[model samples]
Target: MSTPADPGQAEPQFILYLDGEAYEEELRLLATWVHALLLPVYAREVTSAEPWCPRWWEHQEAIARLHGLWLAWQELTDPAAGPSGPALWHRDHLGAVMHELRSPSGPFAGCKQGSHRPKAVPVVEAF
Candidate 1:
């Protein structure tokens, strides 16, 4: 997922996966968009009933899923995707991803409506 040095000069592209090996520039772009765009617009729907992790960056699975969804959103919303793109995104991406990420026992289980901060838990590495 290496970004070209002059990516701005070319067609806009994004990393669809959240691997650590993903380009630093791509990660930065995604992070900015997630913080600046996605959260502010979408997070209002998150509640005690359908919780979402405020510290979603700490969760690798959530990050990967969200990045993929974001990439699909970008692609499907473009004019080049044609009229059916939105339908495909809603059917193939949005519903499932939202369900998983907001499931009661999912990554956001600990998060509540008003208190949305997540405490990071140390990962135990198997060597």
Candidate 2:
């Protein structure tokens, strides 16, 4: 699975999840939001994990990929002119991602409990 390239094939300023006409833009937004929130809450744990830990390695890759997305996110939105556009787009995308996660019957169709990572097609290979 893969995220779509940014318009005109410019190095995708953001991570995108496009599935036919049903583009999963929310994964991209959650990618940004989770990008910001994960470091403080996630990186520390992954970094400190012992090699003996069961899922430490897998978690490590996931963390690193998220960080990469965050870095790109910062690049895409840091400019004075670009921030507003991406930020607003991200907000709407996040809402959409959440709606899908909470939907009655979808990939996230059934589970609507607490915070959950929506299904996404990784843009960068972590495995």
Candidate 3:
């Protein structure tokens, strides 16, 4: 993914599930991407019925899972993956990830449509 760095600056590389100590640069870049690009785009699909957490950044599981999904997206959609890459991404990654993330009992349980924060409710906090 592209970074805020100038074109002359080499972009940082990332791998899924690496040690934070060894991959701080890559981790930061991935976080930036997830927050900046992924969330905004994904938010549009969130309906009141499908709920999503606006404070998803604070949710460790969401971050980790999304990172893994993002990594899979990159690999599965690459040119080298051939003509079926997009189809594979849709079938194998997007469907599963979106279901887990947007399920009624999932990360966004009390959230509403659009860019809303989770509704205040009396429930145990999530990881």
The global C-alpha lDDT for each of the candidates, from Candidate 1 onward, is 0.71, 0.39, 0.66
Q: Model 3: runs farther than 4 Å from truth? A: 1-27, 35-45, 112-127
Provide the global lDDT of candidate 3 against the true structure: 0.66
Instruction: Report the error of model 3 at residue 98, Å.
Output: 0.9
- Candidate 3: clashing residue pairs, number: 0
**Model 3, range 1-127, lDDT digits (tens) per residue?**
5332345655434454456665566567667877777767654466756777766655555666777777776666767778898789778887788788888877777666545454354588798
Candidate 3, position 102, lDDT: 80
Model 2 TM-score (2 dp):
0.30
**Arranged by TM-score, best first:** 1, 3, 2
What digit string (tens of lDDT, one per residue) describes model 2 on residues 22-104? 33453445455664574344332211121112221123333344434454444445554354746654564434533332234
lDDT of 1 at 25: 68
Error of 3 at 106 (Å): 0.4
**TM per prediction:** 0.64, 0.30, 0.61
Tens digit per residue, CA lDDT, model 1, 85-110: 88998899988887888887777888
Write down the RMSD of candidate 2 (Cα, Å): 13.1
